[model samples]
Target: MKTKPNVLPAHNDCPQTTTTGNSRRRKAHRGIEMLSAMGWWSYAIIIVVCVLGMLFGLYIFGRSGSEASNLTQLATATQRAARTQAGFGTANLNTVLYNAGQIPNGWTYSSGTIYNQWNGTVTVTGKTSYFTITDTGIPSSECISIAQTLAAGGVANYLTVGGTKITPASDIATINTACGNANSSVNSTTKTIVMYVGALQ
Candidate 1:
């Protein structure tokens, strides 16, 4: 006398679950694999390019540094020659030649100091004070010598072969190169340097 459950299509109408084989999904997996391979190659190429660029940049920088050092050494040599000035006297001449406007060794001058004076004379005051000058007038520009005769401060005016006169200039590039952007000039015809070194104190 027990009640029985109804087990027929009308009584249980829910749709049964469906299952698909793994073969149907093969296409999606193949596409993913292809994309991964392309990405790996692209990354490798980018890394190589970056390394090569860095090496090239380093090479350029190294060369520039070497050139800069050479220029610096040349500049220092020029300045020292201009600063450590001493007496300029020939074997027979008794008159010592120097920039007239410069400070006399162990003494001082009152003209406020001048670097470029075209006059034939200078004024100095000291215990051992004496005026010094060389005949700077030249008939042609070809009669000049480039030498440094100073202790070590600025660029030395190249003294004439014989300390007979002072020199002046109009153009800069005939006989010598400029010293590290320092103030350098020469006579128009004689290529004489008008610059001179003096005591600064």
Candidate 2:
């Protein structure tokens, strides 16, 4: 009698092995899909954050621009009022400027008091030779920006940022330091800009 020859069984004969292999492949596919979904979510989140940052930056820029324009208008109006009165002469010029239609439009004016873009008090006071425009509740960045602009334009004889006087020679670094100091002071959230313009030439 001849011995039977040894041979391997067909793959279909092992059901358990086939099932295990299929299960492993399925699991790996599912894992790849999950990872792809997470990557897309992360990308979307980054886009949203960037868009929000841009919007916030735009809001700040617009606010600062409006404040600077309003301040410049007020200063010009004050000069006009002073010339009409022949001199500033220690008088409060708010009412005079408002009555003359000199105050900028959209400014909140009540009881001879005008409010700035930030709803802070804006006062116009006069000395013998020059008038002062004092605006409170300005943010530190805007304070520096407006001060530097006016100083460059040669409009203001002198100005103060948070009570720190800024001269023509004051550089950006100096202004930044002054604003930083003011913002860290008692009025931590806001600062003040006081601009002095000459009266009658």
Each prediction's Cα lDDT score? 0.34, 0.81
Best by lDDT: 2
Task: Mark the regions of model 1 whose C-alpha exceeds 4 Å error after superposition.
Answer: 1-24, 77-201
TM-score of each: 0.28, 0.80
Superposition-based RMSD of candidate 2 using all C-alpha atoms, in angstroms: 5.0
- Tens-digit lDDT track of model 1 for 16-43: 6554555556766888888998899899
Candidate 2: regions farther than 4 A off: 1-17, 181-187, 199-201
Task: Give candidate 1's TM-score.
Answer: 0.28
